[model samples]
Target: MKRVFIEHIESYLPDERICNEQVEQRIRAGGFDIQAGLLEKMIGSEIRYYARNDEQVSDMAVSAAQKLLHHYPDRKIDLLIFAAASGDLIEPATVNIVQQKLGLTCPGFDLKNACNSVTNAIEIASALLLNNSYKNILIVSGEKTSDSIKYTNIEKETIKDHFAAYSFGDAGVALLLTTTTEDKGLFYQRHQTFGEHWNLCRIEGGGSMFPNDASKLVFSGDTFGLKNVIYEIAPPFVKDCIQEAGLTVNDIDLICTHQVSKDTYRMVAETLSYDVNKIMQTFHLYGNTAATSVPIAYQQSLLDGRLQKGNIVMLLGMAAGINISVQLMKV
Candidate 1:
């Protein structure tokens, strides 16, 4: 297979910054008594962002993609992929909207895999770039998770299911990938899904199961059960990826991850005996932006100089559907 290099990467976070106090305020607006500092304490996210009411998912994606398209004005995109767990519509794949909004003539499609959507897109695009004539593929993602929070109906029994929602933040990320003759690109990637645990996390409405029920639109999940599974699978799972890549934890210069909870990186650091500084902890700052989590953190690493050209970076992801993936690459 031919090497696939990331030509460029960028992110677009909404202007409206939200702190844990704001999150608590909104929840309290429902006239419910909630423990203060619960979100930051449990989720470890001090701040997250929400797009304005008029902003759509496509808008965010286009904003991110525009940065790349402008950076390389002479380059042409042979293909485009919109990968995300959030979108502006249920009909007409989000990729179509993104392509149209960006005014690109390239063929495009949508890919969804809960929080690992963008990582999966990169895997697919790498294969296509290796085999096909296309020189470059652009992947973009936007998450508007704030739209799904249910502040009003906070029954104590069902509270367990909604805590995960508080950790969610909105974001957009874009990556431009192309075939490379050099070694700086994706080399090893693996994904495993435990479908039986799919019921642990979900947005119950907007699908055929509960089509007409608006109340089912909010995020709901078994947090304790999900964490149990994470602990069981993630440590061994990550060790496998690093071994298969013919590298050790020290060989990995940076770790970009889809943080499903506050303890996501904490678990990785403890299980692997790797330095905590090597891990990118976006959950505390950006919250879980679903599919954008890993990519945005990857972008931040580049800007912060923690990762540089030819550095070994691991894209670690754990999403709903009980999905987990590890992609080792050079940047």
Candidate 2:
């Protein structure tokens, strides 16, 4: 089988930067009484990026994809897979918009698995490469939570839940998965789904299941409803994925888990007895960028000199449908 490697990766944040202190102040002004370290403890984030009101998820994804293409201008991309939850519009698929904007002629489509979209895209792209169907595949994942965020009546839920209303930042990320004799490439990947938990963390009004009406958006107290589904199903999914990779928790050099919350991260780390330091967190700063979290963190790790070549890295993500996916890669 041919090897699938990440040729390049890039991420884009809104021009606005929201620091932890600012978030604390915002929540406190709203009478939430959240401490400064509270968010740090919950999501291991110091600051997060947010998109502007006019910016759409597709805009961010396109910007990041353009950056990646600029960096590696010589490569010929044959396929583009856009994995995202909060796209620009309801119809026409975000990938179509991205394809039009970037002028990318390669075959492209959108993949939706909630937060696990990117992970699923990676698995599919790898299979395509191995089958000689495509040589280079560009995967873009992003989320603009701020666009749909509702800042009122947040006190109805626990701090963890309410914090997400404010804490979840926005970001876009792009990755180039190619079939080459590159030294760094994916080793294995696994995906699983539990559709029973689909309605747990979802936007009840937007999709075909619940068609968004004026009342759904206007009367709805919360936009992305609840985090209970994620809290319930993610831990076991993480463990299963790790175990299926044929490696113990300790074998992972660095875990690039999805950016949900500090509680979620700690629970997974403790369950596997893995060191907290082994996990790279961006939620505190970037909140949950849905499909973009892991890839964004992976890019940051490379920029910061933390993720070096030859290291064994694991990309894990859990999204709606209570879906779970893990991709083990040798960098």
RMSD of every candidate to native, in Å, equals 1.3, 3.5
Instruction: Give candidate 2's error at residue 72 in angstroms.
Output: 2.0
Candidate 1 accuracy as TM-score? 0.97
Which regions of candidate 2 fall more than 4 Å away from where they truly are? Answer: 20-45, 153-163, 214-237
Candidate 1 residue runs with Cα over 4 Å from true position: none
lDDT of 1 at 68: 80
Tens digit of lDDT per residue, candidate 2, span 242-317?
7777778788899888766656567567766789888886666677677888888788778878877689998987
Q: What CA RMSD would candidate 2 show? A: 3.5
**lDDT of every predicted structure (CA atoms):** 0.88, 0.76
Q: Compared with the true structure, what per-residue lDDT tens digits does model 1 show for residues 1-331?
A: 4698787899999999988889889889986678997876787756789999999999999999998889999888999999999988998999999998999999999999999999999999988898885888999999999998879979777777898888778989899999877778889989999999999999999999999999999999887899888889878988988888788889999899888667888888888899888999877788879999999888888887787677899999889999999999887
In model 2, the worst 10-residue window by lDDT is 214-223
Best of the candidates, TM-score: 1
Q: Please list all clashing residue pairs in model 1, or write none if there are none.
A: 310-331
